[model samples]
Target: MLDIVKQWAWYDWVMLFIRLISCFSITATTIQMEDYLTLPLWVVVFWEIIVFSVPWICLMLSYRYYLIAEMLLFGGLSLYLTSMFPEAYLTLLTPAFLIAANSAEKSYRWSAPITIVFLPLLIVLFSREIDVFEIFPQIGLAYVLGFAFHLLIVNHRQNEIIRKQNSVLEQYLTQIERVTLLEERDRLSKDLHDTMGHSYVSIIMGLETLRPDVASQEGTEKLDSLLQLARKGMKEVRGYLHQMGSPQDTLPLVHSLRQLGEEFQTHAKVNVRFRAIGEEYPVGKQVKMTLFRCLQESLTNAVRHGQATDIVVSLYFEPQQTRLEVQDNGHGMENWKDGFGITTMKERAAHLQGRVSVYSERGEGTIITCFVPRLVESADEIIRLFIVDDHSFIRESLRTILEGQRDLRVVGMAEDGAQAVELCEELEPDLVLMDLEMPNMDGIAATKRIKEKWPGIRVLVLSTFQDTEKAKEIMRSGADGYLLKSIESRELAETIRLVHRGGTMIAQDLLHKMLDAQSANEQEELLDAPNISEKDENSYGLTKREREILQMLSQGMRYKTIASKLYLSDGTVRNYASALYDKLGVRNRDEALQKGKKEGLL
Candidate 1:
């Protein structure tokens, strides 16, 4: 009953008020007419109180059956009173309207027919003393108003449901956008690492090889300058890759803010203090970003404009909003206008239905407070991984790369596949990254055992081999993905996520090689059989373009040379060669040649 009262809306309170007034008036009238009653006056008054109190108790307890019973009893009481004193009809109007409205709201089908029959019967009872025409219209109007109120309540509930659904849809869209942005960042990072990093390394190596060959002083000086430039470029590429792979994108609001403060303190050579108040709560990415930018801008202004040496950053997580307060101990401005940075911060907070306030004096430094409305949680489940590799350096490097991702955690590492299988049983990691060329119990055997025991766990093979047979074997052992050690760090991280999401991710080049091997094996088997027909000659499924590429490969023609002769691009020729390999069931050009000679196609 108390819980129901706590959840009552304004309409419920209004109904309660109306119910109270009607009960009091009816009881008061009963007292005034006690002398005309046949039963004892006290007995009638007590019965009246009990009858009125039942509806209130029913409403509170949400007992619909009892409330319906009370309605029937009240109707009988009203009919009895009208018989003794027709003037009692005036006191009955409010109670009749209340019953009709409450009943209709509960169920129109049950209440509508009841109201139509009961209200008119009451009117017919009053028709002896009052005109039937006047009372009938009044009763009709009450029933109409009660039905209208029911309609309004239904419409309000539907609107609430739609509003909640929209809120959920918006959150889903925001999450999708965030994931897409992170994937694009990783793609860009991988491209830079593969292209620019390789080019710089090559340039540095060639320059170092020619350094001793330079005889003149000027030539040596030039060579030395080139070496320095190449090294600098390589260093910059490494920095960019690190920045792109940073955990800032996935850190919680509090951790990200603390990191920002520490970075600011280190670079500005200023003393900084950080503190948080209230229980922390998860917030959306946009809200976090808004607060982050506000703190960043405040720190900059404190140093540049206020010349503040010491700074204090305070974060408050309240029920309604998340707040940030940045105060400095430097000189402050008495009459400061809104600069571009301050305006931008205000706009960002305002976009999230929040606000930014600034307070500054001549000597008290500046205080900037930003408030953003609390949003949805941004935490995701972490994926545990086990690494199986032989080299210590490779194991540590893999750990570092995987740990940089917010959702990925390297829980265990092993030097060989045997150790990996043992630790995996104990750790029960979500995913395993294994190398095929391990010393004891190679990756293929370990993978097979793991899948047999725990089919829920995913296995990804990260090896140096481009060997098609090994890839097929590991895959048959139930590895979810296969890739080479030459894969970019960013790509490796993304692939781990994809595989964890129940996707199979095979390296593109490895897939091409596997297809080539399968095609060659099939063609060789077909050609070795007897009773060969004209269709058997083309059983490899090679097109004219593919056949030409295969013949060029037989003549020791480079892809570039073949493309030039065939009036095709280098990429087109390579695609033709891949197709040719696929049709011949071969892994490489050499395999294709061996099969072609035995079949007399070359």
Candidate 2:
């Protein structure tokens, strides 16, 4: 009963109040006529209480059959009392209104019949003492009013439901928009890092090398100026990347931390020591950022706030969690409180289900420790790489650079395409970093043969050529990614990992050229097949999947590459291609492409 009352609307409370008042008035009026009653007045009052309380309780409990019984009892009592005392008919008006209202609220079909049956009884009872014409309209008005009230309540409840649903949908849309913005920001950051950041670093390195070779002082000074400008640009890029929350995908966690410590030692002129207590392991991007930020904050505070001369940073890797501690030998704070940096550090740690704590004393140094659950990558998650280039120098250089990374293992090296194919058969590396324009068999042919035999092995093209035609050919030959030889070493390693993980990487400029060529070809096909009507186009009845397969085939993509791009199995791609061939009435892929072009379906 309490739970039901808690759920009641204001109108329900009002109805309960009115029903109780009417029950009390009826009881009081019956008590005043005690002289005419056969039974004792107290018994009559008790019986009246039971009659009203039972029906109201049934209504609260939603007992619809008992409500019907209550209606019958009320009608019999009103008729019997009216025969005994005619004035009692007047007091029954409130109970009649309640019955009509509740019945209509439950169901209008039942309410209509119930109201009709009660109307004649009301008229017959009232006619004995008063004119039927005078009271008939009032009785009808009560039923009408009750039905109208039911309609109002239902309308209000529906509106409330719609309002609540709209609120939830708006909140959902806002969350989606926020997520999309973050994704776009991350993508922009990566693009800037891969393109502008790499270019700037290469420029700085080139300038540094040229500085020693310059014979004239003027030339040396010019190179120095250029190097400074390049360094400044790189710094700005790094700051922008930090603002965008870019992940350090290229370097391992330990290397990144060591690099950070080295930078602070060089720039701040403060002694910063870093040590790894346990066996080093890979951690997730969030954990890396949290630890990096905590170290950065601790170093800055030690120099600027604590006036520290030396800082020691320790990283502990455990089975369950990872811990980072930063201690500074400087005058500590007598009273410590969280500022913006410490608060942000705590929030970042908390986001990873971790924590950050600071311990400080007046004379002793301060120690800031962060504890984060270890989200370690598998130890065996290494990319077994094969290098294929005609030049021995290129092959050995790539091997040295890639082998320096913890996750990359150079398993084999091949001089030319022919040797690469033979060695691949025996060695079966996870990825092949193939160089285009090789002697005898080129990279494109070798890639095709390898994909035909081992469709799972990824092939990434590393070449000097940015020719659109060659890129298209290599893609069609089933190469998973393409990169320029001028790409930064770190970017190259990251791209290799990305490709090995079923992602495609292409140089931005080359990708733009390929897209432009594709658009031109599409326009030319449309112009040539101007007479192809919409009905004829629909006649092919190609499904969305079939159309996708056909378009990729037109671009010379092999079955395995198409399957990888679409996240489907090679056998499923073959089935779709076969269906497309039959629908086009073609014997092979070349015919399908030609027919598709003529029909303007590419």
Candidate 3:
């Protein structure tokens, strides 16, 4: 009862006021008409008070107690009052229909039959005072109409709740986003500080090491090296800015890969080639980003440690998958070792439900290949849609529009959350357009249950409310998308199609709000996650020599150099490296290197 009052909005208050006024008007008319039973005036007043005040007080009680009070008052006292004075009919609308609607909304399956049974008794008792046939239809019509009005008011109040919640969420998201951006900028500034400090220290040390031989070739060469270090430090600052300023979408995928190859070629002073096989196909944004990062990391490893003079990056497209391979004509090791880079590549590939493999030999080049699955459109398959909303008009509108498309079909519909679950379980529709507010259950709870039972069934929230918190809650509940009722028909269709193809769709305005909220949350989680300790080789499932080999490789040491340092034959070193690769679950040096850095092994 308290929760209901707390959730109440302006529409509820207005309805309450209107109901009170109408009840008062009917009582006044009864008093003016001087219509009374043979009972005394005080007795009449007692019954009238019981009829009006009891139901009002009942609202404050729990549902079970309230129903008991309502039944005793309305089924007994209300019926008697109406039987004696039919004029009570006008006043009964407020409390009687209100209770009935409340029961229908709160306990639809449990209370409905009882209410239906008692309703006829009330009408039959009223027949003694008035023409039963003449008034029955009128009273029934009024009850139905009142129930409809209650549903509308309830929906309006729900929208009010959503608006209030969204307001709070939007403010929080904006503030968090601001804080996150400031922190990121601070981190970048700190990195720049460290770089500049190191460069300045190097310059100072070179100056201090110089003697009166400042005019000598060695002194001149030292000054030149200092100048070069300063220039390189400045270039590092520019690189950070370029990365921060340019969004990934600004560069086409192929163009970006080519540019990545070209930049590495310029820096590493190696011949690098980029190639694409088969037609360029559509891939998800996350998949594209992963591939790009993998390529960048691979090139860095090839030139930095592979001793490669020539490199090749290739992208191959198939009907249902995209494959990327990076090959380097470098003096490869006798056996492949897993490093931080290689582990990182594998992790990135796994994000797209993909896998990575590596091929290398003692002197021959190394090739790293990653395969990622892509969603493919099939001409023969039809996209099934399920509509779940309390409003018939909304459901009908969606069903009509969706059914008109040849590739899309409305497989089922439900009026509320409980029905939606049952229908979805039986029909197993591909997509569900669910409304947030309903009679028995709500969209959030239903979405969670549906996803848990049938994870393949994608749920898209179709709500009149655009609450950011509610949107996040629904997404957390495993909904694929969220949309507002104000969406145009064409945009709605496109969004459905996108979601059906394993893409997420959020209303543009809500999308921006959610992005702000999610960005802050993601950054916070990223910062909060535990980092791998460099010395904890056992914790990371690595042997001592494996850790040592990884550290040396990170320093750009070759296999022979590492073997000499460790006082082991090159072949023995290779065996230990291969064992590390298996332990790390990585195929190549680049992935291993990436994984090592991620796990703090380097």
For each candidate, what TM-score against the reference? 0.46, 0.51, 0.37
lDDT of each prediction vs. the true structure? 0.72, 0.73, 0.68
Q: Which stretches of candidate 3 lie over 4 Å from their true place?
A: 1-252, 333-341, 387-419, 425-427, 433-444, 451-602
Residues 1-602 of candidate 1 have per-residue lDDT tens digits of: 78558667666777778767777777788788778987787877776776677777776655365447555766666666777777655544554566555663446566555555565567466548866676656756776775566566667766754554453334334433654576567556756775787578668777888978999999999999999998998999999987886355568888988977886676666677989899987765456767877987788778767877789999999986799999998799987666768866765664444667888999889899998655332247788999998866678889998888788899999988789878988998999999888897899999888876877788889876567888888876778778877576665876676567555556655665675777788577657756444542546655445666878889999986775576433434554665456456667989998987777666
Best of the two (1, 3) by TM-score: 1
lDDT of 3 at 328: 95
Per-residue C-alpha lDDT of model 2 across residues 1-602, encoded as one tens digit per residue:
89668668877877678778877887888877889886788877877777677788888766475457566655555665666676566555665567666763446566555654565466465547755665556656776776677667778777765654454345434534654565567657767776787688668766777866899989988888888888999999989987885335446778877877776676666689999888887765546767877877777777666767689999898897889999998789976766667856765665455667788897698999988765432367988999999876678879999998888899999888999999998988999999998899999999988887888899999977578899888877888788887565666876676567655667755765776787688657656765556754556656566787888987889987888787444544665676567557677999988888887787
Error of 2 at 336 (Å): 56
User: Candidate 3 residues 1-602, lDDT tens each?
Assistant: 67558656675576567546755665565566555655565565566566556666666565566666665665564465566666555444454466555554456454444444455456566656656565555555555765677688778767754654454345334534643564455445444544564355456455556645589787788777776776676677657644653254456678767876776666555678999988886565446656876887677667555766689899998777889899998777776766877876765564344667888887797888888776544569799999999867668878888777767889889999999999887888999999998999999999988977976787889886568999888876778778877554655776676677655656645765775786687557545645535345444556456778988888888876775566433434555566567677778788889888887677
Q: Roughly what TM-score does model 1 have, to 2 decimal places?
A: 0.46
- For TM-score, candidate 2 versus 3, the one ahead is 2
Question: Number of the top candidate by TM-score?
Answer: 2
Pick the winner on lDDT between candidates 2 and 3. Answer: 2
Clashing pairs in 1: 516-586, 519-584, 519-585, 520-584, 520-585, 520-586, 521-585
- Count the clashes in each prediction: 7, 0, 18
lDDT score of model 2?
0.73
Give residue 282's lDDT in candidate 1 (0 to 100).
70
